[model samples]
Target: MVFFKKIVLMSAVLALAGLTGCATKSDKAGYAENVVYHVNDSVVAGAAMNNIKNHLNANPQAKIVLVTHGKGIDFLLEGAMDDKGNPYNVRVQELKAKGVTFDVCNNTLVGRKIDPKTVLPEAVIVPSGVAEVAKLQSQKNFAYVKP
Candidate 1:
């Protein structure tokens, strides 16, 4: 029984050591090279933007792009507010200051009867949301993330 206990304890210790080593290696792996988050919903748009903020905080050199289309454009609508009635424009501005790019779809604007001028000034009008995603992927090699 004493020998069995010693073997079990040794195995447990080895398992823990292996796990710790893996965790350290994962931390060293660091952030991805490029990340693009596609925003398609109002609520999810906010969450995705916040995720980008967090990513940027952890990886200061990380490249992030937010592609907004369809209903997602509502998030950047002028005077838009969150469920708590907090304006999102300021948050967008803050993200822009941190080098995050916000891309708005012109097709969505026209389809939704929204004027381009009514969007946040920080947002750049793109030709089409779907096309933009493809362009980013093919031309810029950006990873498409639909969060």
Candidate 2:
């Protein structure tokens, strides 16, 4: 019985290894996919971050730009807090290191009266968030996402 169990475990391990090998092959360097994530509402902030993480994990070379306007910019504020009372800085830093960019709308800053210095370091101020998203999609052929 012990010998049979050992063989089964080894067989399972080998099967998993084979599957991993196939997965790694598909993960080989491929064409870079450009995408722009449009964030206009604060509701989807967490989900958007998760989507970005999954996107990069599946395609490490993907070019991602996160555009924020209005309430969506809350997540990129220096001392912003999520609904759960968690700060977004850690996740922002993590994604930034992985080449993700956070674009904040200048119009929002002025309209909302948020100080420029309060913006997170991972973010760059843009003339307009909506315009930036459109430019990325139209000019650069970047895929658009609203999550």
Candidate 3:
């Protein structure tokens, strides 16, 4: 009878150990990966887009938000293109489909005299791109990336 009780206790301990392992796995999987990408130059936007694509490929559940100002907003405009003449809208749409957000700085638009109508539909205009990046990092616990 004592031997049986010892065996039962051991089994209970093993079961609890298994449950603890599962809990750790669940915690890791449930954690959200939020990232903010800052872009202030159109020339680097293409490389940033590639980095974002690779990031998503590595972690499909990542939440990515891009904030653009100055020349950065050019790529998110209607009929925008890279140096090689590849349309930026297509890649923007592709990333949009994969849950990436594009934000344009309204101040840039006003300073550059760009009409809001000319901005791509996939992008939302924010009051300030720098402020948005600060908010994302400070208030929302997002990691910052400038690639």
Candidate 2 residue-wise lDDT, 19-114, digit = tens? 877765346665578999999987898999999999998889899999999999988988887888899999999999999999999999999999
lDDT of each: 0.86, 0.91, 0.94
Instruction: Residues 87-124, candidate 3: write the lDDT tens digits.
Output: 99999999999999999999999999999999999999
In candidate 3, list every pair of residues with a backbone clash.
Answer: none
lDDT tens digits, residue span 32-62, model 1: 5577789877889778888998888777767
| Candidate 1 wrongly placed segments (more than 4 Å) | 1-32
- Point out where model 2 deviates above 4 Å: 1-29
Q: Candidate 3: misplaced stretches above 4 Å?
A: 1-31
TM-scores of the candidates are 0.77, 0.79, 0.80
Give the distance in Å from residue 36's predicted Cα in candidate 1 to where it truly belongs.
Answer: 1.1
Q: Count the backbone clashes (under 3 Å) in each candidate.
A: 0, 0, 0
Q: Pick the candidate with the highest lDDT.
A: 3
Q: Rank order by TM-score, top first?
A: 3, 2, 1
Q: Ranking under lDDT, best-scoring first?
A: 3, 2, 1
